[model samples]
Each structure stands twice: as C-alpha cells, then as structure tokens.
Target: MFRFLNIVIISLITSIVSAQGYYDVTKYGIPNDSTFVGKNAIDNIIQKAVQKGGGTIYFPAGKYLTGSIKLESNITIFIDAGAELHFSDDFDNYIPMVPSRWEGTTVINFSPFFYAYKAKNITITGRGLIDGHGRNWWNYSEGFDDKKPKSKWENTFFENNKNVLAPPDSKWLKRGFLRPPFIQPMYCENVLIEGITIQNSPFWTVNPEFCKNVTVRSVTINNPHSPNTDGINPESCSYVHISDCHISVGDDCITIKSGKDEDGRKQAAPAEDYVITNCTMLSGHGGVVIGSEMSGGVRNIAISNCIFDGTDRGIRIKSTRGRGGVVENIRVDNIIMHNIKQQAFVLDTRYAKSTIGPVSERTPIFRNIHISNVTANTKDAVFINGLEEMPIEDVSFSNIHLEAENGFDIHYSKNISLNNVFFSGVKTSLVKIENSSDIDLKYLKLEKSTEEKPWVSAINVDGLFIDGCRPKKGTKTFLQLSGKTTSNIGFGTNDFRNVSQVVVKDYDVKKDAILK
Candidate 1:
C-alpha cells in the first residue's frame, strides 16, 4: 500500500509539471547594459517564467547582483561556470514577507536570498556560484556590531496571543529557540542541486524542509566561521542522497533535524531514509549532527565513508530530556577522524537550557546504534551519557582505535557491547562505566601513556563480562555494590577479587585481595 501511495504521488507531481507552461529565463528577460545594474532582473525572469508556466531559467556566466530570487514549479535555474549570482545587501529589497519556514514553525518569514516553495522538478545545477553575500546581511542582522562577535542567525517568538508584534524596548525581541536556515526550499519535490558552490550564507545553508527525492552531490559549501552556518539541513524530508560533497562551515557540516519540543511532537513527521556517503568535512562544529530539534522523530539513517578533520566532535547525537522522539536504527561505518577537539563519538541526552523543567513532550530516545571500524586521534576517545531517568540501550562499538587525552565514559545505559577497542590516556581513567547493565567488554587494552597515572578501572554494572582483555595491574581498581551485582563472569585470565558475584575460567585465584 505504501509503495502504491508513493507511485501515485509521483504521478500526480508529474501531471502538475506537465500542466505548467515552460519558458526559458533568458528569452523572457535579457540582461542589457542599462537594466543589468541594480535591475530586478532575477525577479523579472522568475515572474515571466511563472506567467508562462514555469520552465528552466538559465543564469549564464557573468555577475548578476539582485535581491531575493523566487523559484516556481517546473523551473530549472541553470547557473553555468564563471557565473556569480550575488544577493543585494539592501534589507528593504527582501520585504513583503513570504510564506516560509523558520526554525520549526511555518510562518510568513523573511524570504531567503534565493527562495523556492511548493515547487516541483526544480533544478539549480551547474558549476557556478550562488553567493548569499551574507557578510553584509549577517552584520546588519546582528546590529552591525563589529566590536563584538556576531551570530549567523537568531530566533524570536511571537507574544500577545499570536499577534504580530514589532521590535520593542520593554517586550523587546530576545533570541528565540529556532535559528534561521539559509538556502531554504520548503515543501519542494524532485529537487536536484548538483555541482554548485553554495557558500557564504547568512545562516544555516542548504535547508530543504518537507522535500523529497532531493539529490545534492558534488557541491562545495564554504562559509565563515560564524554561528549557525550549517552546510545542509534536510528536515522532514526523505529519499535524500548526499555524496561527493565537501563541507566546511561554522556549525554542523550536515545536520538532520525535524522539529522541537511540543511543537515537534504535534507535527509527528519524521525525517527518514536518508543516505550520506563518500563525503569529507574539513572544519565544522560537528561532522554530522542528528538534532535536538527532532521532535518529529528520525529513523533509518546510514552514513559511510566519511572523513572528519579538525572538527570539534564527530558523529555527535544530542538531544534534551523533554523533546520526545525516537532516533533508532542508525548505522555508521568506515569513518576516520583526525584532530577532533572534543569527544570523537558522543550521545549526550542532557542538553537542557533552563536547567529545570518537567519531562518535556520533546523527550527523545536513541537506541539500536551500530558503529564499526572508526579510527580517530582526539582529545577524548568516547563519551556516552544517557538520561539518568531513561537509559539508552542496544549500542555496539567495535574495532575503534583512539589516541586521546581521556578514555571511555559510559553512564546510565543498558545492553552495551564493546569489542576490540583500545584507549591510551596518561592522566585519566582508561574506562569508566557506571549504572549500566549487560556490558560485554572483550579484547580490550587500556595502556598507560605515562607512569604518572596508570590504567584505572571503575566498572559499576548489574551484569558484566570481561574476556581476553589486558589492563595494567596494581593500579586497576574496581568498586561495586552487593545488590547491584547480578553476574560477574569472565572467560580467560579472569580477575574478579573485588567483584561481588564472580565466576571465572582458568584464572589464578588470589583470594581476599583488596581491589585498587
């Protein structure tokens, strides 16, 4: 039934495209010398295309400076190589707010520099540049304060019972939750954005919301090291294929987000079945981030053959307590991280802002995660902290080699498995597991970087299994509670003198030994 539904949807879209008239952009409007400079050439072309039933609007190789350019159905805007389509810096040029999506809400938002909405079979493909000319707008939006560092985007809420309020002093507009996204294409389908250098956006770049069959490949995304400049944010979309792309931005290189909190839960629209492969991220906050805005929930994501260099964190999955959603069945493989500043792999569920609130409807769940063959040189090897109230489960980490400042820290989780993993840290504990259950640690080696602080062990689990692992003796310690020990089992060369309930196979027994 679902397959049939998909087919019907595709057919309906095709019919709509056929019904629309098609016109070329250059034929409808020409860029002459007199009207070329400061002329609304792009708007004129788009209007003509819309009037004549949308078709491919071509941008030939030259510099075209204008304000916001709107896209229509069946319109394919082709930007050839050496073409530089720049956005005007005047704010009033983008006035008359258009229907758009900001943060998570659907509002009459400020239009993107290049905007498209509810369009079909739209293609913005070429080896050219679609520069947002964001520095002017970004500076202006932040009140043009050069002395202080500015942000890429800002979020503001509407007060006074859904009425549009102006910027004021007392009830002044403070920063809201949702950051504005750049290159926004909302409710668009059959989209193809290939081989374009989409850069310098004022905010999060390449945002495709409620879109489908979107193929973004061979694109180079370069932005300033500012706040909220994400490369691509595919929110509430499906069948997305992102490959052969080079992303270097201020925020997450490629982030997948849905909605946030109660607003997200009410939407209940998941961003599912997306594939990202063979991509390289040069510098960013995160290599790939799956949101705290996932109120609509996310599932069935696969990422492979990715390289992260000089990033703050790699493979980061972060969410708050109240955001209620389930992010499961994620598979990441063949990842290589170099010079990661923070934790190489992290699942932080305690992303709270106010530090106090009820269990929000946006409480999210992360489980059934499988990661393998990940090599990294970083400050911290691994960091996984589930919600103390709700434990994360069914996670596996295998064949990971880390050269870092700290070791693994796993807390408040269940059904955890670690195999063939090694960590080398001089001043920190090699492994620390607390308030967990069914942990299977096998073929592990925790080596000391220097003799100052040797390999220290802190394992607190209900059921634990240690097999074929090598940890430095004399300094390794274990602490436990009697009621917490369910089954402490080991395979070869077992050391369980400090454990409460212990069973060993082929181990030299040292009875009444103090574990430290």
Candidate 2:
C-alpha cells in the first residue's frame, strides 16, 4: 500500500507539471513571419516560463528569426515538426561579449546562437532545424569575399586597428574577431539534446564546455567544407554519452578536449568517462580524435561499433610538447573503416611544429591503450610517432586486419604487443621499427605488393621477438637490420617460403645480431 501510494503521488506531480501548458512564442507577441525579429519575444517567453516554475516553450510550424536565445533551468525548448529557427547573420546580434572559452582558452567573446550558463535540467528536443546562416562568418574568417558584405561591427573593429586584418596565430584572440559556436551550454548539469538537425554552424556545431551528465542522441549534423566547422566537441566535461548520430563535417566528427598549453594545465579539468557508440562518420578529418588541446588529460574513454567512411583518419590521438597531460585507459573495439585517405590508427606525439626541449611536466604522455576486432581498408595502416624524450608506452593490438597502400610505422615506443594481426596489399615494408624496445609479435601475416622490400625492418631496436610470422611468396629477405645499436633480435618457429636470405645487415654493424 505504501508503494502504491508513492507511485500515485509521483504521477500526480507529473500531471500537474504537464498541465502548465505550452507557452507559445506567437502568443507572447512573436509573429510567425520571417521579417520580424523574435529575440525579445522569445526572451520574454523564456522569462515567463521560468517565473511559472518552469514549463515548455513551444514554436509551431513556422520560421522564427532570432539573434540569441538564452535557456533557463527546468525549461525545455520544443520546436514542432515543421518549425525552423533561423539565426541572424548580423554580427551585432551576438553582442555584449560574454565569458566564453574559445578552443580551450578562456576569453570574453560573442555569445553563441543558443547560450545557457550554470542552469540545470535543460533540454532542446524536436524534429525541427536550427540553422546558423554562417556563410558570411566563414567568408570573414578567410578574408574579404565578394559574396558577403562587411558587417558594421567588423568595419568598426578593423577601422580602429588598421594593421590587423585577421586573427593571430595565438590560441586566445580578442573580441570582435572570434566566431561563435551554434549551441553552447557552459557549466550546466543534466543537459539533454536530442533529435535536432543542426547545420551550417559558424564554429563547432554543438559544444558543451565544463558541463556534466550530458547526453546527445539521434541528432544530425551537417556542416559544409569550411574552416573549423567541427560537428560535436565536448571540452572539459565529464559523464558524456553520444550515440546513434550521423555526422558529416569539415573538421573532426567528434573531438574530445580539455584545454590548451599553459591555460589547460591551470584549469586541470580532464575530460573523462565518455562513451561513444553506434555512430556513422563521413567526410571528416578524423572519425574520433583526442587532443592537440588536452593538457588537463583524458581518461576512461570507450568507443565501439562505429563506421568511418571517406574520412582522412579513422582514430587519432595527437599532442605536442608544452601540453602537459596524460592520456590513459582507452579501449576501442569493433570498428570498420573504408576508403580512409590517411592512417587508420595514429598516435602522433609531435602533432604540430614545436620546439624540442628537455623532458618536464609539460611533455605529454599516452599509454595503456587496447584496440581489437578492427578491419580497415586504407592508405596507411598504423603510424605511431612518439617523442624521443617521452615515448608512448604499453599499447596492444589483437585480432586486427588491414589492407593499405603503405604499412605500419613505429618509432620511439616501448612494450608494444601485436597478436593475430594481418597486413595485406602493402607496397612498402610491412613493418618498420625505429628506436623502440621490448616488442613482441605473434601469429603475424604479411602479404607483399609489387615493390620488393624487406618484410620487416628494424633499426636501433633491442629485445625484439617474433613467433609464427608468415611472409609472402617470392620474398628475398625476411629481416633487414640497420644501425649500430640494434641487438638482441630473435625469431621463433615461423613459416618462411621462397626466401633467399633470412637476415640481412643493411649497414656496417655487429654480425651477432640475430638469434633463432
């Protein structure tokens, strides 16, 4: 009887909340005509809903032009099936430089089209579209374009500083030059964005910064081939879940970041506990990318059951020196890649141009990663380029198959293990090892192409072991050793066919290099 009474009480509360009725923007003096600007009317409606202890603000089947709409706690913005929210192209609409983070650095800039701050239990859901007419923004970023007119804000800002034409190379930029994101929620909790079609974002489409308990599902993102138009970027947030989304953008489909070089270390809020599954990626720079701005560190990430087609890179992790961070405990499984233009799997420690110096806390660290059950047809199979001062550590791959134009490139790494891995249709050496140590390969198979190169080449490697490796037919030399520092290489019982020489020294080094 107590449980029954509790259920009845909860149902009564829910009904009472629903009975508050939808606060239509048209009823609040906002017209459905496209000529009228609905910014004030929408803001008034949102305020009215908040005053009523939270309700739904509904937009029925029309095109509503607005500048920026701020959301409040316990409020839901619902657009009907045929309704479309069109953002104004004028730069003055996003005024009064709010406190925002631009690409991992904190600065006061223009407000996003849809902005929410420090609010809870907020949602934006419907079958309608939120469009950012971003052609003018994109053109201004690239320089003067004949198709777009110069905005008054742009003209005034540039007129004061006649020498400055565009944004500087630094990560942090002043106001009046930074383009805003489409939808941004900062320091909010219990956020849910579902079933909305977002297109032509000025910056990243949907960015949630410093938020928690966020869930984005069943959304569609379509950004044109413009600069910095990423699909969904979650920065310095925790407990994020993104699933069942279709994304086609110019930059990375889904990028996870914390912060940038010096500013990132100060914030020290790592992006953690993320789960991305059942997503389709097409025409992006990378399917899923981590860092370049991950100074606060990233951990406990799991990606599974995704498809990447016509992407530049399938899975990528990149960081440079001076970005002090540690990325660990990552697992990716059951991924399929087709027509990848670049490497299928890449861990680049030297992502961009940076001065090399002594190892310190500023140096980035990537380790403790496991990938399995992956199949890729790409141009390059795998590329691991770690820094010499701080090498990548403790990574493993199992049950993987790849067909690529080139092969694996491993450098400055340690404790790598590969089992049941196959490489086919490779024109270059099947595996190239450089400045690495403590490697193990088991049940490895290599199929050669027209280019007759050594199947395995090692330089300055120590404690290398190979077991049950099957080389392709008509191979002259199975192993090619170089550099004076190479030592302690061993091979177990393997299948060798039509090979003239088992080991060949490419340089004037020690003769006692191989052990069987």
Candidate 3:
C-alpha cells in the first residue's frame, strides 16, 4: 500500500514535465551506449531547448554517460523509468571551472555534475537514476584536507588550475581535486527535484545554494562510506520544503547551512523558513542537522514526522564561538528514532575554533527552540551545551519517551522547560546541570534503580523549579545541590513521598537556598 501511494505521489510530481513539450534525446542522435561520453550532444540539446524558449529534455529507457550539465531557466530534464543518467568518472570532463560554493565558502571549482545558476522555474523529475561515479574522485582526494600531505606533490594539477581555485588563501588550491556535488542549483528560484534515485555522490547530493522556493520531494539518496557525501544540503536558501525523501550517506543526511564564518557573515543570508517532514534517514551522522557552518544565521525551521534509524544523532544543531550567527525559532515534533549511536537530541554551540573574548558578533546564539512528541532508543538521552558568555535561551522539550544508556546533561543554558518526559534505562547517576538558570521539569517519569543516585545534580545553578513530577519509588536522593553559588531552587508541587531526602548539598551550598 505504501509503495502504491509513493507511485501516486511520483506520478503527481512528474505531472509538470508531462505538460511540457519534450525534446527526446533519442531524436538528437545521442549515443545509446552506457560508456559513451555524449557531453557535447547533451550540451547542444540543452542549447536547442533554451533556443526554443525552454522545454523538457527527455531521456527515455537507456543508460547515457555524460559530464556536467548546466541548466538554463524554465528548463526541465525528465529521465523516464528505466533510464540512468550516469556521470563520467573522468576528471577532464569537469574542466573549465564554474562558480560554486563548497562547504560554505564560495570558490571557482570543478563544475557540479548538474548545475544551474541564476535560473528560474527549473526542475528535474521522473523515475530514473542519477548516478555519480565517485569512487575514483574519493581516492585521489584523500589525505589532502590535512595541511601537510604524506606523499609527494602533483604540481601540474595545482599549476594548471590555480586561477580557478578561489579565495587564494583557501586550501582548495592544494587539494585541487575537491569533488563537485551531484546536483547544485545556485541562486535559482522556483526549483524542484523530485522522483529520482541519486547515488554514489562524490560530495554533497542535491545541494541548492542561495536559491529560493526550493522543493525536493520523493527523492532517494544512497551513498556508501564516501567522504563528505551529504544528502540534500540546502545552503543559504529560503522558503524551502523538503519532504518524503530517503537519505543514507556518510555525512549528515540533511544539513541546513548559510555558509561559514567570515564568508558566511559577508554573505549575510540565513537559511530560514524551511519545512522538512515525512523523511526516513539511515546510517548518517545526524538525521537532520543545522550548521557547523551557520555564520549567516538560521531561523524559522520546522521538522516533523521523521523516522531516523541507525543514525549517529537524531536531531543535531551545532555551531561554535566565532561563527557569529543566531539560530532560533526552530520546532521539531513527531520524530521516531532507533539505534541512535549518540545523543538522541543535542544542541551544542562549541564545536571547534573557539576563542575567549567579550560577547560581540562573533558569539553564536541559540534560542526559542521547541522539541516534542519524540520516541527514541539511544545511547544518551540529551546533551545541551551553550557558551558561558551567551547562554542558549528559551528551549523546551515535551512528550519525549526515551530509553537511553546515559542520562541527560545540560550546561550554560536558561529558560529551559521539560514536560511530560518519560525516560528509562538511565545508567548514569544524575540529570546533571551546571551554570544554568530558569530550568523547569514537569511531569517527568525517570527510571528508578536500586543504585545510589540523585534524581538531579546541579552545580552553580539557580532558578531551578520542579512541578507535578513524581520520583520513581524508593529513590535515595531527590536533589543534590553543590557549589556556594547555587541558590533559588524550588520543589514546586511534586510527589516525593517515596524519595528519601529533599535536598542533599555539599559543604559550599547553604540550606536556605532550597524552597520546598
């Protein structure tokens, strides 16, 4: 039944191509052989379509090998069922570099396999295969992100292509073999990528940068353990809707970004107003991630109805100091996760390259986020970390049912509320908190164990409140407070009859800090 439903959805999605006048590639004398390099023929066909005021270029029921395809405005490439659009593995096919962005930095690199720039009303649809033969690209580019390479030099690769590599300061000139994305539509509007299976990506797959009104639906992306092969990365784009996609790649499945540090701040474009729903992810770093590259700020994202299985983390939002971005107004609901290798939910703002300074534009900010209706089985339940200077603010978690090996950890945050949370299999001693304020726990059902453990352990924390929460039967300690700075803790209307003690404190904390 689900398969039939998918068929119906794909048929509906492909309707836009069906309505257009099609120029079949068979009629253009392109080779039918799978090994043929029909780059010129394909380019000529695209030119002809553009000359005729734009039309659908159709490839029907065969394997066609080609290189980079540059799309024009109002053009649609419809690959019919049983058709495979395979990209050539030869590096020479991607010569005469194009303007592109790689990992948040703008550069003139190898042409993306399917690229569109400043285009409007473009689409790639139909039930077909878009394969990037990327094994060779992966091998040649290995061990080069390192500043010092082990092997000797390839001077020609750098000397001949030095001018194309941008920023001059970038390491891309050194690693001249930085592979291109499978599909990247930059600065385009009204873009759609639907009803296709894309695999073997050399780098990111289905990446739409600086584009608006983008929709990627019913697309399946499968990449093996290739380096940096992310799926469905929409960077610096707005009004994006990504739904009904299946992704399993080496890196983050769906990474939302707005570029990185200095360049990102210069671009000053946030990847905001996004809706990601009804997607299934498998064997990736994070199911749905937002930035380690969000210096341009990311906001107003809503993700729902997603299933993540065998991913490293379920929902991850990560950035660091010196990023100079604000990530806020995010909502995540109705997510199911299993076999999460790391934390089920994490919001970390200290990833890499942090420096001590007064709070300014360099300090990344996270605020106004809510996550609810999540069920997960994972190694750790939650990990939330914020900076000391700029704490993460106004975050909420509700209706979460989780079975994790470790307990929750939070630090340097404020205005956090956890409601209707059911947690089990917590092997760690306490739900630890440090250097935070205004934390409220309501209607929580934490697992009870015979081991000596405190329900919550806090240090240097203030404005902590617990309401309508019942402790597991026969728990030893209710609250363990430490540090002389800790104060203003209130046990508000909670059932602690089965617990032994109300407050257990270290030598530094005063008993007057507790209000029961």
Comparing 2 and 3 on lDDT, the stronger one? 3
Candidates by lDDT, descending order: 3, 2, 1
Q: List CA RMSD, all candidates.
A: 9.1, 5.3, 5.9
Please report, in order, the local distance difference test score of every candidate based on alpha carbons.
0.71, 0.85, 0.87
Residue-by-residue lDDT tens digits, candidate 3, 45-134: 889888878988899999999989999998999988999999999877886677888888776668899999999999999999989989
Worst 10 residues of 2 by lDDT: 164-173
Report the Cα lDDT for residue 333, model 1. 92
User: How many clashes show up in model 2?
Assistant: 0
Residue 462 alpha-carbon offset, candidate 1, angstroms: 1.5
What candidate 3 gets wrong by more than 4 Å, as runs, is 1-20, 145-173
Best by lDDT: 3
Candidate 1 displacement at residue 244 in angstroms:
0.9
> Candidate 1, which segments miss by more than 4 Å at Cα?
1-40, 50-53, 141-180, 353-360, 446-456, 471-516
Tell me the deviation in Å of residue 38 in model 1: 6.9
Give the per-residue lDDT of model 1 (tens digit) for 322-399: 677888888989999999999898887776553434444645688998889988888988788887666778899899
Model 3's lDDT to the true fold? 0.87
Which candidate do you rate higher for lDDT, 1 or 3?
A: 3
